[model samples]
Target: MPSSHTSSTSRAPWRRHPRATVLGTLAAVVSALALVLALPGATSAAPSSPQAPQPNPPQPVKPGEAWMGAGVQMHEGDSTDGSVPDEGRRNLVASVHGVDVSSHQGNVSWSTLWNSGVRFAYVKATEATSYKNPYFTQQYNGSYNVGMIRGAYHFAVPSSSSGAAQARYFANNGGGWSKDGKTLPGVLDIEYNPYGSTCYGKSNSAMVSWVRDFVNTYKSLTGRDTVIYTTTNWWKQCTGNSGAFGSSNPLWIARYASSVGELPAGWGFHTFWQYTSSGPTVGDHNLFNGSMDRLKVLANGG
Candidate 1:
């Protein structure tokens, strides 16, 4: 989906609330004063002893692989994948790499994609209630045939159709998941409306209710939580910072910058990050947030 924003910063695993930071600072000060008071004959004017060596704070564990430039590996064919050669791959901050596609990409060569080190794919299946991608079957099956983890996504249109109706349509068509250890859970693409108003003219509460309806219905049918594909701005503007889905749904964040940026409410970390739309493969380029083992666990419905 086309996004309105451009730049974003890499996000930390946890977003500390401003109130929490203030309280933590005050507690530290109070604890230091109490320690001094407990010492024998200690006074505020007493000479300070050499401070104990403080251990370095632990660094956030990054993905297994570091970000590399796009041209690290290249193929001789035309950029049929919408991949932005020598550009999209830079500043990558994730471990595993993959691609997502739709009819807009035309016919993709899945084998070629796999040969280029693509490990997974998310093919667009349906949009709203009536529109289904014409090339969904070939794209979805072709990725699987090429031995890549595969999944399907639905583009949401909450104003035009009810969430339950769209979820049923998506599941029945191609978004359903199987425990075969190859298929990933379905994705709900809920971002810029792409039609009229940004939020499809729905209030934040209504939008949140619609999303809940969609995910709940999808879970009832497939027995798996749907992955949510969204940008931080859209989530905040449309959903009013709701954390309802954070505990249950996995996040697939979209940001076309050097960093992942602050995420929506609820999610501490994103499972998949759609870093760039103009990747060297097809459609959007993404990273699985962990190692191949974790990817397998996700595929196996863990």
Candidate 2:
């Protein structure tokens, strides 16, 4: 909750616009200011379909080659259609197929994520009891205008002075969790932070109490179970995989991998898995999270 916002000068260029300002939680909003930057002229200039030019031969991209238009950042792979075939991308772990995004990553066009095969997304909303995130503004406001099922997650500060207080802070921020039953439910991010010692605490009981309290209160209030976000090490040392409030409250396991095949065995019931760091995108902004196929399943109440 203590100013997760980064300095504006360091952000990506896709964020600074009236259109990008449509975020929900304050944490998300602040993230927008810090995480994503606005390119001076990121707007699209390519001629629509018929007006576009024919394909050109492969040009070796020299070091530091930059794109031309505003907001025009990274380039798509071959197949000007914007699709990333399995051959070009790094292979992924089997379980981890989703992506976890903070405001730092810029605008995600639904079409790009959809076309490339994103399953689900856990958009950061509230953090601890006080910080509100601004990263979700675009997605909450309009990116879904193209239709993608999304869920919300609260950065858990179980080590807060009052665990219940932190839970209420998160619940109150978004007028309670989204009960659409289509979007993924709330998630409690229980990570270690050298500066966030108070948020997560240094002991196991404290962390467990913090996670349980938040999950319990959120479920009671929203009529939906809350998920836990943690790494394998944190699970063993801090959380202990003691089990959630019930079967409804699943685990969103985050384990970075060169490929999903690299993930180790046996943690607990994983409702969704985050497999990659960078995936496809609609505009210049890089989509930070997982696939659309998984997203639809979670959306369909699977």
Candidate 3:
């Protein structure tokens, strides 16, 4: 109801000069748009699609080439892939087909492996004391859920820490075992030192002692002797062909040959043989060296 002069005087800055205010607002909007286009990961180019192409992020080093038969391939110069396993060892000694996997093969399709006659699997759980396979839960539990008897293995790094300490780390992380008829005893993958000299620069007797400590500690923690995974050549080179663990721990021999040739001194025969790096399925293929009943017996702490 005020006079026009009084109303004009009381008008806000924008209302008094709407054209100038609109120009200022448009300038601010253009400046902001310019700033956004100037920033990294955004460009001033014409719109190519609904979204800009994101740059490929850097990938962390994956544990792809360091599991199971890696030592035989690295140190001893042996491989059994694509070679029919001496015309296939299923015809020679082992019957039950199995597999071993690591985080290298992420999120395994275990149901596919199970339906394809793989009755057992070993998943790498820990490396040294520091690394735990990031895909451990999926690989381990997935294999079990699909009715495959699965176990966990620790890749040993003796020089980094004591055997007992590494064993503890392994157990505390993912290498635990129970008599649930589905979980096999944890395995100690003590093969060639992938980091350095083959024997970890330890004397033969010292190497033997290190393995003994790891085995003892794992047994104390899980009430099960760990399955020892190694090549006959590596066992001889590192432990001086020590036959100490043969009787107590089951052997998971890594030999990519038609037959599981010579075993380490202690083990009369291998319970599990990693026969090929490339199997018919996703991971390394192995043989359980027995029937399904025998595999269950091992799982049940037999």
Candidate 4:
């Protein structure tokens, strides 16, 4: 989950001339005195009754905004009191519904998920040169058995390991692809680093090189382009808005807002949109950018 910390700065009142400041203070005092005098005196002066507490003002709502809680960020539409309407779900900006999961979701009920209208799934396969999801086998195979298109993703650790090494490890473990129409291409989950610095303390060019290495290695192993999963902020900050992989790799964008907003450089459109992390489904809610037929073509290595 991404941190939603926001900071605000207050500027000191400008007083180029001291006389202006004194005049402003005098005016404020006069207004305060007038307001005080306008209020009526307490009638009869009996035992004063306690005043009722005023209700707090409603907070402003942002369309497609998400609240962070319970170690996950839940979109407003996916909240318990605010579900995406059936019409909205059926007619989402992106048509096909899906989900992405990891060991964090524990043992998932793939059948229940399929029944709930999940057409595809991306399961976490590996992180860096180590850390394979313990439940990868069950989650990967289970989704496929339940008739959902399945794919695997690697959590990128550009700071600690060479991208090629990590890619090789991921492919060997679960990121490999086949001509089978049910399997989607492997994904590279590269976003905010969960470890240390946001950019993994690397220069923008280094980050781009790292990503290219990962994609190249994965492609060599699978004979299919790796899907690049990222957020707009991360793409700009870490990769310097490079679109080197845009032509070859499909994009899986994460945005919890109502609108997709501006995408990274290179890609004119996104293939996958992860709209919410805590949805009715047991993982991140997503949408394939097209119809089932297009998704099928992608799965078939088109």
The local distance difference test score of each candidate is 0.64, 0.41, 0.67, 0.64
Residue 197 C-alpha lDDT in model 3: 74
What is the alpha-carbon lDDT for the whole of candidate 2?
0.41
List TM-score per model, in order: 0.69, 0.56, 0.75, 0.71
Q: Can you tell me which runs of candidate 1 are displaced by over 4 Å?
A: 1-94, 279-282
Model 4: colliding residue pairs: none
- Best-performing candidate as measured by TM-score: 3
Steric collisions counted per model: 6, 37, 1, 0
List model 3 lDDT by residue over 1-302, tens digit each.
10100111222333334555544433343333223212322212222221221122112212323566555556665454333364332232224567677654555566556654567888888887788776678778887998989999998878888999999999998899888999998999988865567887899999999989999999999998888899988888878899787777888888777777888997766677776664212346566666566677788887
Q: What is the lDDT of residue 86 in candidate 3?
A: 48
How large an RMSD does model 3 have? 27.0
Over 1-302, each residue of candidate 4 has an lDDT whose tens digit, in order, gives 00111011111222433645534443443333223212212111212331111122113212111111111231123332223334224334335667676654445666655655567888878777767766677778988999989999887778888999999999999999988899998988887754457788999999999998999988889898888888887789888999787778888877765655788998877788776554312345566766676788789877
Candidate 2 lDDT at 259 equals 24
The predicted structure with the larger TM-score, 1 or 3, is 3
> Candidate 3, TM-score vs. the true structure?
0.75
Tens-digit per-residue lDDT, 5-68, candidate 2: 1112322333332322222222242233222222211222322221111123124322111111
Q: Cα miss at 117, model 1 (Å)?
A: 0.3
